[model samples]
Target: MTGRHAVPEAIPQESPAPAAAPAQEAAPGFSGRLTAPLLIGSLLNPLNTTMISTALVAIGHHFGIGAADTAWLISVLYLASAVAQPVLGKLADVLGPRRVFLVGLVVVIASGLVGTVAPSFGWLLVSRLLLGIGTSAAYPAAMAVLRDESARIGRAAPRSVLARLSFAALGSAAVGPTLGGLLVMVVGWRGIFAVNVPVALVAFGAALLWIPADPPGRRAADGVAPRLGLDPLGIGLFTAALTVLVFFLLDLAHPMWWLLAPFAVLTAALVRWQLRRPDPFIDLRMLAGNAALSRTYLRHGVSYLLIYCVMYGYTQWLEEARGYSSGHTGLLMLPMSVAALVCSLLGARTKGIRGPLTLACVLLTVGAGVLMFLSGDTPLAVLLLAGACFGIPQGLIGTSNQAAVQAYAPARAIGSAAGLQRTAQYLGAITASSLIALAYGQSAGDHGLHLMAGVAAVLGVLLIVLTVTDRALRGRT
Candidate 1:
């Protein structure tokens, strides 16, 4: 029913060129470049999350405020993201992922313009929320485009290409901290965002020119484009439920016991509503029936949680306890990006071999080992090495896990599949970080390190569990 369903192949061939009209002149691998802009253009959205993190303390100082109060900039973005993913994803599939992606590009560009003139932290929060809204388009839209392109190729790509497509997209995350940090230093945090304006312009221009649109003559088997009739009511309920849930949990450190009751009530109501809907915003059945699929989603979610805890928490520690500058912190994170980038590319060669999963498991276990080894007095070299270890897994997790999910998900429901995938990514991050915060967040030094290691160790074990479950599930089928 979705635009992403498998299309019948035209003929047998060694390589299947993607389905689309050729432009005025063709270059080698033209379709690849045609698709590149989607992923490349989308990179800055997640990059914003990483780059702004190191600057939070500095920005707080600039605004004459405490870091605690200014934490909303980050939370608001996450809140926007958690709420935005389901709705924007549904709309992208129906209205056109390209159109939805452009909205994100525009939102980020406009936010940069506003941040250039922001008067206070409150104004910055307003800009960040808009930025979040725009970024919501990047991941789902990028993946959806790639999914469609793969289907259009009209021939099965031997799986490696699929892995390559995903990891390559994820590999862009490696560029985030490195690029964002350098920009923050050269032009300040606003400049970090302003960089998007040019990238968006180019991507917007390219999308209009190169990316193929669904042809006019072919009617969808469903009569209308599946996107035309997305369940708006389901979308509303889903977003409202998630936004409220994120808010309640995000404020948990305040010990808001008064909110606990109502939050629970609202969440329960949302689930019941979704269950009864003719077209639930997210299909719970797909997630429920598939163990491999479910494990992939759970691990994907948990992995990001671990990475954020490491990335943000370390950024805070380096500044508060060890006296590193924002520039230095970003610089230190570069090796991580490099490690992740390399593995993601290399992972393209390792599909279904257990190589990617096994390597990921090894890297995370070692990364956890190195994290536990870190200390306030530890030398910078050792800390950077620790990050590199973590980066290897961080880089592969998004792409590799996504590839696994898609490899196993039913073909017709790529949008919902991705929605489920993105959902786990958000859920993993929010739940894991929230727990880590509760355990040792108040303490600002080595004690936090020790406690965080315990959290990482537990997560590492969970990753192993995920690996086992995936293997067992694959075996059953």
Candidate 2:
């Protein structure tokens, strides 16, 4: 699955090539000009996902809403992202990634402006929904760009290059709360929204300058008719199915089990429709045939389920049960972020995918087991150690699973595949939220933390089993 092959060499260009030149002629390696734009673009989704966490209270107070209402501020983004990622990814594949990426950034800028001046909570929801859809374009579009660059260069993307994208996402997410808090302190919750304008503008400018223009004849290259079809019915069914599923998952504490009926029906209809289309929005048949890619998505989803459980649940436990201030808890959690950053670099340097993944699962299991020993009086060192244990796996799993997706997915479908990968992660995140809500209902006490840890431990063990038994991953690096 490593993308090494002999192909025609192409000269690297810092500036845009003429429109007549083939789009794939830009570079022969993952150069700075190429990596810079992708790195900046990739930061949007994770940054937006976490940054809003710190501002929820201020937002709720300002709008005179309860926790449940404010909670939608978070859920709405996840829901929108869950639907938009693949849809935009499909558009990127069809319309050209550069175009889709730029449009997405523009949408982000507009969303930020709307959010900053939102007159009511409903407008705030609209802002978040747009933010979700806008940010959704980055990762998948970047993935498609990377794949195209790799093909142009005739080599697999170096692990380090791939890791840089992971680093951007992880680092941005790690700092989101701190950054958001500082912005809120200096300029109120509006700062969180307003800040996106300049950052996105810079990214947009860089992207415009550095990223190569799309080839003029994509449809021609594909040997298809000049007019392209986007499979709208498939997209609509997919959106409906995912929306129903996300809502059901969001309210798992008091689940609307009846929603499952519609979800199942939509999914079945989607499957039936997709199998008949030459250009389905989601290529279910490809997934059915590609067991390795299918497993990659499952592994990614389960791995994140454990990670979000720790990221969100453990922090709540620290503040509520251990009697730490939010600031102190954030400080304590710093070790996890630091460890994840360091290990991501280290993981990128390694060659074997299964080994790192196996090690990650083991560490995850050990971390969960350590959580079992925590109490109000547990030493600070022990807490830090637990955090590091979980952090190590986070870095390893993220890069490894990403590489697995790149290695396994069909070249033509890389964009949508990457988007589905993110959808898997968001689903895991939503599931983790449900799990935390169930375990820590009124408060994140010692017993609740331990109960959650037990579940996490079981999940970690399952990850280990999944990793070890997959023959497709045995010789992959």
Candidate 3:
């Protein structure tokens, strides 16, 4: 049982009839109660992901490892989530979202406990892997649950439900590092992981009380639900291909040219295999037809890559190069977090991806460009101002990309499409971890930080161009 926060895939196939209810109970906000538990669950994944950024230096110091080696803590988790989220989402569609959601919460609890007492770096990595797998379940399952509720109660639109979840996710992301910094200062680096325990426990109880059970025999009655014939072969090949690709990317600075051979071979095989299957793990043909959706996925990955570089990359440099304590570093980074919260709300109201996403790219460029102008002795006010600019994109990109995905994904494949959207995001996170390691090398410094920012600037420009010129992103039908 694992879940990550994701958009609910599609409308259910069999939406029998809406149940009779009082007028007050039939309103839109009525479904808001269901989001209470789902919101709590949604926070876990993003919180765990970003909170550790503030604590990474402490963990590396404790383990006597370099920045590059300790980066695996970030990379491994994203990698696991990228592969696991879609699979778990499919399971939620099959086994019942409530059941899967509870199980995921339990896994998070166990992972937190393991992390609290981890005696070695290896043990900590294991805890992160478990956490990634477990947290991956929440979003997809919650999405399923939300859709089911909409279906069962006869709601024409559940846009508000998703907005609530999205806002919760971004807000948690904004708070993660600050909360982690406080915990690290109070209870050492381990506190970041330990914190998940109490939060997950509350989420578990709420989920049990709020989320309704699956309508009996939904799966049993649909004897031919695609879950019955999942494409194991396609899944295996895709996972293997992705793993090889990750290795290749992580070793990009090195002369590991030989790795590309296997990566290319596996990727080709995966495409061929998936295309041949009657029900593929990922439908390449659908991706081809839904060009807008594919572009959204790519934009998510690229945008997140830049975001993580700021989150983890900049945090590491502030501590290692600028002599800030973990707590102070978190405090300094608050402007970015706060700005993201404000901008996300504004971005949500935009008509399409072009405006919000372009604004996101512009902000990204401004943030990263500011970093390139700063030295170690640069004013704290100036640095914080740059962070504020960076934070704006944090909120905007997420909501805009999610809206685009929802608009473009086919009704039936919504769950898988949402999962893949998340996968692209995680892949971006993984790429960021790799880039941070490669850029920062043995330790973080101003030079490396500047280089990373330059890379971010380049990405921002590319994203702007794509948003305007790409057919998929230009609001084409």
Give per-residue lDDT, candidate 1, residue 377. 81
State the displacement of the C-alpha of residue 457, model 3, in Å, after optimal TM-score superposition.
1.3
- How would the candidate models be sorted by TM-score, starting from the highest? 3, 2, 1
What TM-score, to 2 decimals, does candidate 1 have? 0.85
**Per-residue lDDT of model 3, residues 190-220, tens digit only:** 9988988999999999888878878665542
Which candidate achieves the best lDDT against the true structure?
Answer: 3
lDDT tens readout by residue for model 2, 225-325? 23455778987898788778877876666889999999999999999998888777777777877888889999999998888778767876775677665
Q: Estimate TM-scores for all models.
A: 0.85, 0.85, 0.93
Pairwise TM-score winner, candidates 1 and 3: 3
The order by descending lDDT is 3, 2, 1
Q: Tens digits of per-residue lDDT for model 1 on 159-228?
A: 5444544664566566666666677677787775567677777777777777777433322323444535
User: RMSD for each model, in Å, please?
Assistant: 4.5, 4.7, 3.6
Flag regions of model 1 displaced more than 4 Å: 1-33, 143-168, 217-224, 227-229, 353-355, 432-444, 472-477
Q: Quick one: RMSD of model 2?
A: 4.7
Q: Find the candidate with the highest TM-score and give its number.
A: 3
- Candidate 2, residue 476: lDDT: 76
